[model samples]
Structures are given as C-alpha cells and as structure tokens.
Target: MNFKPRFVALLVTLAVLVGAAGTYIGMQYFGDPGGQKQTANADQGAQNFGSLSEEEQKEFLDKVGNTDLKKVEQAYSVIKDNYVKDVDQQELVEGAIQGMLDKLDDPYSVYMDKDTMKQFNQTIESSFEGIGAEVSMVDDKVTVVAPIKGSPAEKAGIKPNDQILKVDGKSVEGMELYDAVLKIRGKKGSEVKLQIDRPGSEDLLTVNITRDDIPLETVYSDTKTVDGKKVGVLEITSFSEKTSDEFKKALTKLEDDGIEGLVIDVRGNPGGLLQDVEEILKQFIPKDKPIVQVEDRNGEKSRYFSELEKKKDYPITVLMDEGSASASEILASAMKEAGGYDLVGTKSFGKGTVQQAIPMGDGSTIKLTLFKWLTPDGNWIHKKGIQPTVKVKQPDYFYTNPVEIKVALKYDDTSDKVKNLQTMLEGLGYDPGRKDGYFDKETVDAVKAFQKDAGLEVTGEIDEKTGGKIEEKVVKEVRDDKNDLQMKKALDALFK
Candidate 1:
C-alpha cells in the first residue's frame, strides 16, 4: 500500500487505462497572436485545464513550428465556425486526447475524462457503489474478471471471462472501458441488465443484477472437527485495503479456538494490493524469509520478506482455482515455498506483473506496468500458472449440469460414466481405490457396500435404482449444501 509520492496511483486488478501528462491543457482562443485566454466554467477548476505557464508555453510553441500551430488554429476555427451545431470546447479537447490514446492499442492505457476519473478514484478507495464484480477489457470487449463472493453479481451468476455485450439493452461494443463500467454500474437497488456471452454456450444470456454497496468482509474463518481433530477453515473472498488486518484477526480467533490444522481457500479471488498479501504471508512465515521478488523494468530486483518472529507450526493447505490470481498466487507461492504448505485445487489464474498508478494534475490517472513478480524460488508464473501439490478439480456437477446416470454400472464397465460413479462412491465414504474409468472388483465391492448402507438390494452390480440413489447422495454431499469434496480431500490429506 506504500506509494511513491510522485507516482500516486493504486495497484488495481479492475483498473482501466487512463491517459495523462503532468499538467492541465486548456484550449486557446482561435486568433489571438499574443495568446488566447481559456474560458471554461470556473466550477470545473480541477476538471478543466488552463493555459500552460509562460515558460512551458514558449517551449511548446518553439517545439511545434509556427506553421503547425497555424494549421491547428485553422482546424479549430473550421470546427467552431463551419460545424452545424455549437461545439463544446471541453468535449473537443477530451475527444482529441482520447483519439491519441486509442492509437496506443493497449487496453490498460486509457483516457479518463473528468467524470470517469472521479469514479476511478472512488473505486480505488474501495467505497464505490455498484454490483461487486471486477472487470477488465479483454480482446476489445468488456469482460468480467471475477465476481465478488456473496455479492449481487455472483448471486446473479456473473462468472469470470463472461463477455458483456450490452448494458440496459444498449450495445457496448467498442465503447471505452470506463464508459461501459459506468453503464453497467448504477444506484443501489436499481437493476442493470447485462447481456453475457459465456464460453461453451452459443446463446447470449441475460443476467439482471440489482446493484448495491459491496459487502467488504474479505476474510472468513471457522473451526470444524475432522475425525475428532479441530481444523481451521480460512476463506479469503478477495484482497482489499483491510484484508491483511482481517486475516490476522481471523487467524487469532482460530488459534483461540485451538486448531490443529488449517485450510486456506482463495477459490474466486481476483486479487488486490500487493502489500496486503505480503502482510498475510508474514503471519505464517518466519522473520526475514523471502516471500516474493519483484523485478523492475531494468531487471533490478527487490525481495519482500516476512516480518514475523516465528513461523506457525500447524499444517496448512491452500485451495485455489482458475479465478485465484495476482496476490492470491503470490500468497499461494510464498506459503508453498517458505512455509511448506500443501496446495490443493486447480491451476491458478496467472497474472504476475505489477502496475503503478500515476496521478496527473488534471484529475486523471494512469496505471503503468512497473514490475514482474516471481515466486520465492525465482519461478515466473505469468501466463503459466502454478500447479497444485494435490490437483483436485472440483466436480462440474456440483455447480452445473447434473451428471447423467445412464445404464447400470458394474464390474468390468469401462467408461467415463463409471468413473463418475467411482469418484462419487469414494467421496461418499466407500473405498473405490481409484477413480479411473475402469470399474474393477474394488469398484464392485464399494458399490455393494453403498447398497447395503442405503438399505437397497445388496447386489454387486449398480442397477437403475442404484444409479439414482448414487446421484441423489452425490447431489446431497456435493451440491445440496455446497461443494466441499475438495475441502474433504484436504482434510483427509492433513488428518487421515
């Protein structure tokens, strides 16, 4: 969270590209040789620009020859006099600036008009009003980076990588990122209809989200008894300004409750401040231990360290998924390298670069890439994400379409359906040995054991009735409440 005074911009995952120089730039009157006076609304002092200081103005005029200056004046006069309607000087200036930035072709570099700049600052301060979802411009389209957990956006099923096609029935194609965000975000309790194009689906889905002030609880923890041993479950929804503080408090509460092990979940986290993550890692890592190394553009490296006096001794398991990115990956990598924690879940969303925001005097800001982050061991995971120590991909049926229970499955049946059955059986306490598609003798015995427990026909083969029962149990154990098979596996690895 420490920012250099000259570069007073925030590190943000959902930030838009803003274009800015060091000072205000107001337009001059068309035909004054001495220098035209700027006459914008006085109320927009910060938003409006005035003529440069005398020395700077002389320097600029000298740099651009008088011929080019005359040409610019002629163009301005043409637009002012020949245009059918009255032209707003501010709009013309802002438009010209936007055109220049568009040529950069970098989605992260943007031009923020006064209004957009206000919203951008509000968001950076973390007190904005809108549907809680992190968004970024990807492939010239407005895409959802990640929906905040338990927010209206997430509840409405706005998923990561969903292409937003329209807002309130208006096409947003080719619109500025800030403009698209402004259209999508609205007053609390007001509804904004988003046309989403999700991957794997041909049809465009309309998701209506009722905007609200996002809930700011970034950390949650509780203790659960697993095989008579107390295990702490610490789930971080996302990193925020106060995330490290919240994490410390959660860990203190868990310690007071006497936990024997820990499970850290960062499943849908998009990421936030780099300092917050470093502080969180400090709690479990020993003093002076390297957490991560940041290499600047010139290849000069700065290593961040843990400030803790002693490392925590309990076994820790980190849970991650495709949505976990940036600081989440930073914490995961540090914990694995320095604390020797076990990582369980799918590959992470790899985003390893660092950005620094530079605020301009004209109420605009620019976020520029400044560094590339690496793991404690110097491994770079930019486009290539970190693989988990124990790869446990969450079953799709837990949140999506139900697994089809087709023909009866028994010993010698070799198909993906049998694999699903075996995985479910193992999840429900039956020892199927392996989850490979082949239904061997071990699978048949596990099926018979499940039948006997469920009070069904105790046949070794899975019948139609048995398949339905298995599906029901799988739904109950995995879906009816929430997906916890990954968590169960983590606990099994830690305790049993």
Candidate 2:
C-alpha cells in the first residue's frame, strides 16, 4: 500500500510517540491537559480553514474578508482544467492540505484519510499490530522516541532518538511520523527490517524486528527498602485509558503498605492520553499551584489545578530520561515545579505543544498543534526539555550501539563493531584488554569466554549470532536493577 497518500504528517505516535489522541469527536483537544487551542487567525498559526472551537471559527470567519481563497480556488481550477496530464482531484486537494500543514513546520498538525485514520485508530484504540516502538519526527527525520518495554523494538536493540533511515529498504527520509509508521507496521510474526542512524555509532545500524502486540500494562508497582525505610516504586509505562485508575490503585496499595516515600518512574515512557497523565498528576500536586499551564496562540495562559489542599506526607521523586516525553514530560514538570518533588535522571524528550484531533465525520481526522503547554512556573519547555534536579545517567554500557557483524570477527581484526563487542564483553565481566577498536588476542579470549558461558561453540570469533547474543545480554544488563544508577539515586533522593 502507498501509505503516503493516506496519512500526511504526525509529530507523535502511540505505535508507542505518535500524538496521544483518544476517540475523536467533532473536535477534542489532547496534548498536555488534552487537545488544542486553535489559532486566532493565520497569524497565530491556525490555518485558513480548520477550526476546533467556536472562537476559532469566529476568528477564521472574521478574517475571511481579509484573506483571499479565490486564488487557491483559481489555482486548483487552472491545474484541473489546463494541466496536460490528468491529476487525481482528491490527490491534488489532499496535497494542498498537507502542503499548508508542512509549511506550518509543525508535524503535529496533520491530516489522515479514512484508511489511515482507521489503521491509526485501531492501534491507539487498542492493541497495536506493529514494531513496538514510539517514534516522532525530529528535525524532519523519523526518530525512535522510545521502544516499548519488552516489545519487538526493544528486543531488536532499538533505542531512543534512533533516526530511521529505511524500512524494508525504502528510505523514509522525508515521510511524516505516521507515514513512516505505516511502513513499519505489519502483522504479528512478520519481520520488519529497519536501518537506523543511532547517536554514537560509527555507521548506521540495521535491525530486524518481528511485529507483535505491544505492551499496554501501563502501571507497575513494587516496594523496596532504602535507608531502612520502605520506598514504594510506581513505574508508569504509559498514560492510556486505564492508566490513571491503575496508578490510583497502585498508589493506594503503596500508601496502605506504609511506604515512607515514593519513586515515580517514567523512564523510557513515550507518552499517552492527557486525561490519564493529568489525573495522575492531581494525586500528587496540591492546590497551591496549577499542575500545568496551557498557553494559547494569543499569549493567553489557562492554568489547571488539582483540588488537593495538601501535599503528600511522604517525599516523592520523579524519575525521567530522554525517552520520557509528552505526558511523561507533563508529569515530570508538574512534580518538579508544582509538587516541589525531586526529578532524577537525564533530560526528557521535549514536546511542549498540545494537539487537537478534529473529526471530519467521515472517519478521517486532522491532528493540529494549537496550544503550547507550559510547566507550572510558566516555563515553556518545548525544545528545551525539563532538566533533572539530580541528573543521574545509566552506565556507559547502557548507551552502547548494536554490534552488527557483516563478517565473522576473528582475532587481529579491528573495527567499530569490534570496539562495541569489547565494550559488551567488558560490561558482562570479561576482560577484552583494550577499549580501542582493536581485536587483540585478549578480545578473542573474551569472546571465547562469553561463548563458553553462553553454551555456544568456543570458536574465539564473533559471528552474526555471537553479535546478536552480545546485544541481548547487554540489554538485559541495562534492565538490571543493580545497574540502574538513576533508580538508586531516585531512591536515595527521597530521603534527602
């Protein structure tokens, strides 16, 4: 299927960073608090057409006298009447629509035909049938925001900010976020090949992932003893329909269990519904300040507040990383600025605008970026993400690139792949003798040691299979609690 015509552009994804849109009605705003605040006029970035609210409609109509669409109509008529080759009128019209959105330079404002919207609704409405990862258009390239936890994307070694070069050999260079997702989406058990440009790799990485039903559990909770105090850990994977209720239940249980503090972990979380995250924030943020402030195009700010009269008796710490975005960012900022809680971890995937899903009543939809949501302190954290109060990054091994082996790597070989292999070996407790990209005899011995322990033939050589195994072990080590320096710091921050 030529997905280009179906979906024009998108900023976020629920394929796990597509926009966090719920069921679309006439027009519903969804971003930070939920939905958009359309522009007052073209000057405010609202198009000459679409209006999600009555105010936007009135403003658009008021500008109707000043703006001339006769030129647009005349151009369309000229093209349809005089163009030598016949053009699909629908295609031309859609192109014009997308062209306008593209010129806005905002990927969040997008148009989706019925077919694309159906597929999109199917994914976000329920289980997604695709490579489990959240992606966004960053600097016009389709970048992986974060792989779904324990999904095909994560299993294939996909990481946050991975710029997707191709899908099944087709370059997605200029495709919209959703259009790229259409290329990545497939049936369960079917493999999808992705070529990615990761941050630190010397070359592009090629990964093959079998599509599957992505994880939707949303909330995970447990308790641990830190400083002789029971510290409750509530890990929010995503803010879906049921996520707020799940969080409430988890928090209730933790509070009932006599926890002295809480660690709210939103690490690697892409984003989700606004209501879900807002609800979760209300539980922590008191009435002293708004949990979030929504700024419209007219420089008007509307603050949303929780009715809670007091803060939580116990201290709270919010754990966030670069992959934590959208609604995750909402929670992180609110906790930091409004709730006065400590934020621990690296920076966030900055997305400060909210999008509105406007229904055409034909199952087609347009997601338009309209509002810029500010942090509680009126700080616009759009491109500038919310910085951590106590920044704690993971180990160097956690950020290593995949070891793509085109040829078997034997002793005396030297390349970037060899350097990656050495890092993994060292992370796994084997001594490779050198961190430089050189495969010495000690590196060969390290591979042999890993091979023997992994039950593979002790061939002292790193093959494609060996590389895959090494990547898998490295991912496991990254997920290990003992290696999670951020979580340790978060737990420790609660006490201070």
Error of 2 at 111 (Å): 0.9
lDDT of 2 by residue, 1-496 (tens): 1111112121111110100122211111122223332323223321323333676445433544223345566677888789999988767766666666678777566777778766655555466666767766668887777777777777778888888899899998876666677678777788888899988788898888888776467789999999799999999876777789999999999999999999999988877777788888888888989988887777888999999989989999999999888789999999988888899999998888887665544455567766788889998887788899998888778878977777899988888888887888899999899979898988988999999999988999999898889888998898788998999999998987
Q: Who wins the lDDT comparison?
A: 2
Candidate 2: 10-residue stretch with minimal lDDT: 10-19
Question: What TM-score does prediction 2 earn?
Answer: 0.86
- Tell me how many residue pairs clash in candidate 1: 4
Per TM-score, the best of the predicted structures is 2
**Candidates' TM-scores?**
0.69, 0.86
What lDDT does each candidate get? 0.67, 0.74
- Tens digits of lDDT, candidate 1, 256-299: 88899999998878776777788888888776668989987667
Deviation from truth (RMSD, Å), model 2: 7.2
Off by over 4 Å in 1: 1-87, 92-105, 121-128, 287-289, 399-482
